[model samples]
Target: MFRKIRILLLLVVLLFVALGTWRSDSRLASWAYVTRVAVYPVAADDSPTTAQFIRELDAASFAAIENWLQREVKRYRQTQQASVQIRLGAEIKTLPPGLPNAPNTLDIMLWSLKLRWWAYRQEDGENIKPHIQIFVLFHDAKRHVGAALPHSIGMRKGKIGVIHAFASPEQTGQNAVIITHELLHLFGATDKYDFATLQPVYPQGYAEPERLPLLPQTLAEIMGGRIPVSRERAEIPKDLSVTRIGPTTAEEIGLLAP
Candidate 1:
């Protein structure tokens, strides 16, 4: 009877040890949460008719932004083979310029650190506050009149990787790329395009782990943003190539991956 009891106790301890090891090694250990986005209204000075027009445009812009975000989440999931699912919320109220130095000049910028933290804390369990990212598009005109403007992500570490954009609704199409670009920045992905020359930034080691090419210039990689290739032939740049990454890049940064 004593020997049997000892054997059972030892088995229980070993089971717990194995469970702990599995949990530690599991790639899906850190549960992936959904991203919630809220678009607060900014200060604008236009007539009621103009206001209606702006509202319509804003609605369209919101749709485009949501669609783009979903697309990016899908792409990332495919590449990473991650079990972490991304949930997204609707476009909510727009925030007023809280800072004294902030522009009342039809352009709004969200400092990733500021009051945004409060926004998350204030929420009830009714709304799960996953990592949040804010996207802002600034335009002075009728909200649909201007060239698509280029934006720069602020150097400060961003939560939810906010991108404060300044552009008209007509130019908002390119804003999708900008939004995804900023969000990815939070994930430690570098830009494939160099800001200096306004050209592609093709470093040999740009793609990590998978050695996937960063652009069409080398191999067939989505990081290059090439998709829906023609049925007949897929044209990729000869210079682009991929290499195998053995525990570096994301894993090195401790992104809680599988």
Candidate 2:
């Protein structure tokens, strides 16, 4: 009788936990309030360029992201004056755990847990926890001239993002594009591009899919990651101005009614 009672109590606790998790996710997606996103700049390498770049950073440096998001939210007819807020946090000198190359399921799971634990100890510049946390790692452009930076990843489960970016003036807009892309991922957006080819899928990936000339698209869908120029080639948008949140992406991020 004692064993049966203990099992029943455990089951009840599990059920409540599950329900609480579901409700929290639902609330975030509901978009009733502004989602606060904290951005922490990190120096990827010990280069003078990267160090100076990090030091010059301030909250206003990320206004492009806030502007783009606001326009998108209003475009979708969301009543919230501010759908999302980006506050620059203090620079983190340490690098987060790097993603394992060719990681298996178990490896990825373990890395994710470790990353979350690391993020939990971080202080959001304001000392208060934000709805989402994005750690941006900036690498010296000259240092990585020949090699590409690591891929950025965002976890919807934890609402955290680890982004790799360049510390060059020219790449500022492009950096925001990547950051915004990962930011939406935290809000439940999925990549609409094909992994094998890195091309935006049919209609979901195209910003204006109904355009008469689908090729040479003027704008790139945010989730698609690039502007489809030809059946065989695509180009990256220089900035968020050339990128847009499509209907499908809007739906996924709760900007549109499902």
Candidate 3:
């Protein structure tokens, strides 16, 4: 009789433990980060078309961002064994230009950013609310010294805008990293860009100053945070630190298991 009672007790304990684990997992998956990209149309050939440049640059930028994100998703799953899904959705069509007024442009952008966030928000949770959605905007400068601009979080609440701006399309992935860097700003991460001498900048942002490192080391290192270190004005290999998204930011988005 005692032997049978012991077996029954063991079974009950096992069931309880299983239930507890399942509940914990359910809670952890309450939030998700789904990504969708939208590209502005390519400008006409040599038309001074800001639209065309933006369209091309964003394509490259999205590719770089997606590759890095996918690798991070795999690494996070292996490390945490968490079931939370981080999905990359299909790229959507860019919105048509708004009114001619500059103020209208800002409003249009803010709304567009919200819409993108909403699309992702509807994916998992019962409530359609997301902490933030990343927006990449392309802008053409009207004058000789003009440049392209990416959407900024700062413009939203001034709380901490995570927007980025790029001058041209050829620097897509590199420009995309700026968006990644600004997004990290929301999480209180400082720029690793070394600004020591000229205007009294904080030091120690560059990780691989020599501009060379193997795969795993680059990903695991701290300096590989968001932006890559430039070597003699040239971007290092994409496979380096920029390949891995920061763990700290990933955790906040619930992409990593706690």
Query: Which candidate should be chosen as best, given TM-score against the real structure?
Result: 2
In terms of TM-score, how similar is model 2 to the real structure? 0.90
Q: Which 10 consecutive positions of candidate 3 have the poorest summed lDDT?
A: 196-205
lDDT of 1 by residue, 54-152 (tens): 455444455644554444344434443333223333333454224445456343334332444434443323454444335343445444446543343
Q: Order the candidates by TM-score, highest first.
A: 2, 1, 3
lDDT of 1: 0.39
- The lDDT, on a scale of 0 to 1, for candidate 2 is 0.87
Clashes of each: 13, 0, 7
In candidate 1, which residue ranges exceed 4 Å CA deviation? Answer: 1-33, 37-54, 57-126, 141-167, 203-258
Cα deviation of 126 in candidate 1 (Å)? Answer: 7.0
Off by over 4 Å in 3: 1-47, 55-61, 79-135, 139-151, 154-164, 183-243
Could you estimate the TM-score for every candidate? Answer: 0.44, 0.90, 0.41
Q: Is candidate 1 or candidate 2 better by lDDT?
A: 2
lDDT of 2 by residue, 110-190 (tens): 898789778878874475678788999999988876898888998877678999999988899999999999998888899
* Cα lDDT computed for each candidate against the true fold: 0.39, 0.87, 0.41
